[model samples]
Target: MKVLMVSWEYPPVVVGGLGRHVHHLATELVEAGHEVVVLSRRPTGTDASTHPTITHISEGVLVVAVAEDPAHFVFGEDMLAWTLAMGHAMVRAGVALGKPGLGDGWQPDVVHAHDWLVAHPAIALAEYFDVPLVSTLHATEAGRHSGWISGTINRQVHSVEWWLANESDSIITCSVSMEDEVTELYGPQLPPITVIRNGIDVTTWNYRQRAPRSGPPRLLFVGRLEYEKGVQDIIAALPRIRRSHPGTTLAVAGEGTQFEWLQQEARTNRVLRSVTFLGNLDHTELLSWLHAADAIVLPSRYEPFGIIALEAAAAGTPLVTSTAGGLGEAVVDGVTGMSFLPGDVEGLTSAVREVLDDPAAAQRRAEAARERLTADFDWHRVAVDTAQVYLSAKRRVRHPLARPDIPQRPLPGR
Candidate 1:
């Protein structure tokens, strides 16, 4: 099967897990003997001299980039114009795929889009080509802000998400928890959603299991420095954790809005000197740290799926995470990893200390985590499952007017 994936974030311009998810999914699909093409916004500071650029990266995979423009953005207004402009670029790329000698027989049997950022173009292309549309909602606008739809921009985003949910033939989410959220948000008007959890390639880490060491342990946290991410909670818990294991050190990797605030909080706790802020380490650096760290922590207040937890398991590092949203579904408490209540400083401290206090038991749990990763979260298995969804969507016959829920739009050749 041939597939066209539309995403606002891709390599060299990733904002979060969505970009990595798209990259791996497309790569695995190609390995499964399918032709895949990606349409995305050009990376920041890319050469904008070219109008429409299509670059063939590898066998069975190609990427199309449209120039990015942010001059119309305001401080606090809705970004509908920028979103639509990116959507228009995707529309142009979709049109190219339908033409001969343009994208080298790149026509797609299924048009799959990730999140609401690229929904407009995904819907337009599917309608124009009369093909099946598949949408994967990585996370919703309301979910990100903890169900607060306060401003006009927030409502606009939710409205776009609703339209996309209704228009698509098939919807995919990372976990059962996310599936429920999508259903509740769309209120019984949505198509049948398939719960296809995100996956990790364990081989990429190239790590081997190691026995717990007899020294000061390192606790590692990798994520954006934001309130919802709960990085500050980790900072607050560190002092309590240190009292038990005085030599324990915390290494934080990632950059975000709350970087300075987190630093201040560390100082307030008087554990500033023990905390090391490694801002946004690259893949090699991150993996090296993962291999050395005694435990990995993810304290997200709202996580659709915890990919980092899977990575920790693959690295044979004991995991500690807050059981919030899909995270509870991802990590089995007291089985694969330890869990704590979201934003609970004491619980977070105890969870980390569990691994620190008893190294042998933590090692046993980490081994169990690796076994679970092999059984459940391999990329090959996920790719095959995703292919099934594509096939099901492709087999369905679609017509422009067949779905009256979608808003009317001009056809490609009209």
Candidate 2:
């Protein structure tokens, strides 16, 4: 099926798990024999130009990136300001395609949007082309940060999230936990929501198992080290964990607004020297650290779905995460990995200690994790599942009289 996919993040341009998730999802969709076009706003390069909504660009699948420059409008605290430009660019691409041979009067079977970032365009294009609109929300800010953060201007962000959930023909979320969040926040206005767990690419992470880093057992935190990620909790656990593990090292491998505070937290905990602030790393560095770690920790206070945990599992590294949102969903509680209560530094310390004190246990968990990830979280499976969501959305759009017609699909440039 011809699918128009929209997201704020993509590979190479990706900032966090969302980008990686979208890229893998699209890649797997291609593998599943579907045509996919991705519309994302990115830093402008020289080759930027007007184009058709791009067709089968991947092997047996088509992916296109409609780029836009958002750096100028994004200065302070506008980390995701690119989403606005991305929405505008996607709308422009759709309108341009409708003009002549570009669209060829042939509409895509459906328009699929990744998050609220592309909601405006998804709603617009679906209406313009008279097709179905499907949106997959990764998380709500309420669930992600555990509070109401959409104040004032960025309240527009939350409004858009609500708009998309209301506007789409159907909606999908990464976990059951997130489905509840949407229902709670958007009420009856939200579209029919389904639980589709996020997935990872196992091939890149699969390698000849190597011995983990010795002396200092490496613990990794690989996402944006923001407050919502509970990075400070990792630092707090370090003080006690270090007393027991001695040479245990925590590598903070992402860049965000939380860097300096984390650096300060390290000093406050007196585990500064024990922790290595690896700053921002490229994919190679992240993969190398993933391979080297005795355990990868994502002590998030809130996470919609923990793709990082799956990546760690795919890399044959034992995962330790808080029993929050999808972090708990990915872990099988001592089978694949272990979990601690949210914000429980003591519990966090204990979980980390289990893996650190018993290297053999950690190794066993990593192997089991690899097996579980390969069996359940493969990108190929994810692609097919997401394709099913697309099909489901289309079917629902076709039978609007059976279900109350959701007003989201045909709004113009909304």
Candidate 3:
């Protein structure tokens, strides 16, 4: 089988878990005797004139990274415009790939789109190739906003997601919670949605010998410092955690719009001294911290699926996470890792203290979590399940010209 994947982010341009997910899935699929081609955007600083489309083969997968169109739009300032411009560039690149003597005359049996970020080009290319369209909704805009499409941009994003869901021959969600969220938001008439959980490469993230600890018990939080990520809740619970385990320190890794806000929050709670904000660590640095930490905490209020929990597990670190969305499925409470209710500062404190107090029990849980990774969270299994979805999509029939009837509401001023 030949698969064409469209994503806004790929290796060396990773914005989040979506890039890693696509990379692993594509490589695993190639290993399984399938031809995979990924159409993605080039690194931000690369000049388009010199490198309009950079093609390379990595791990048996053909990657065509196209430079963004020369437009004066900023992603943060105007997301819709930036996305459209990106889609335009991707569409041009994809079209050129199908032409004679171009892109080695490569054509895909199925087109798989990662998210709404690449929806326009994916949809256009699938129709252009006259093949099945498969889409994976990594996260939804309405889901991020807790079901409220209040702002104009929020509604616009929601509309695009709805269109993608409806246009797809098959829809894939990383978690059961995400499947439910997509179904509810896109309505009942949408195509069949599959729950294919995200996976991790355990080999790359093995247990390492911990360096001798000296001062304080380290609690690591490795994720974006966003409001929904519940990083502030950890800062809120830090004082209480310190009361039990004196000198318990929390190290936050990753950057987001909430960085300054979270720092202010720690200061407000008077646990500023106990928290260290390590903004955006590389993969190697992340693994080092994962091995060195006493326990990894994930307190997300709206996680579609906690991929970081799997990474922590693979690193053999004890986990104290929230039962938010697919996190409940990822980390089995008492079996794999200790889990608590989302936004529960008391529960977060208790879980962390449990890991700090009884190191042996935490080690037992960490081992169990690692064992679970092979049976459930392996990348090979994910690729097999995803291929099945692609086959199902190919067998199904849908009108290419059909448009989704997404309802629109007038803006407040209008």
lDDT of each: 0.82, 0.74, 0.87
Q: Which pairs of residues collide in model 3? A: none
Give candidate 2's TM-score. Answer: 0.87
lDDT of 2 by residue, 1-414 (tens): 988777766755676778878888777777777777776654443124543223445444344556554334553455456556567777887666556777565457888888877788888888877888988888775555464554454455666777777778888888878888788877775567878888877777664364745576778888887788888999998878878777778888887887898889899988889788787787687788888877888988888888888878877777899988887888888888888998898999999888877777877877788888877777787778778877877533432322322222221111
RMSD of each: 6.2, 5.9, 3.1
True lDDT of residue 178, candidate 1: 90
Off by over 4 Å in 2: 44-56, 67-72, 75-83, 208-213, 394-414
Better of 1 and 3 by TM-score: 3
Candidate 3 has its poorest 10 consecutive residues by lDDT at 405-414
TM-score of 3: 0.94
lDDT assessment of candidate 3: 0.87
By TM-score, the better pick of 1 and 2 is 1
Best by lDDT: 3
* Model 1 per-residue lDDT tens digits across residues 1-414: 888899988886687778889989999999989888888877644444643355657545688877754334432243787788678867977798778897655567899989998989999998887789999998877776766666667777888898888888899999988998888887565677999989998888766676547678799999888777888888888988988988888999989888998899999999898899999887889889998899998998878897888888888888999998778987888988899998888999999999888878888888898888888888888899999999888424533332222222222211
Error of 2 at 277 (Å): 1.7
Clashes of 1: 0
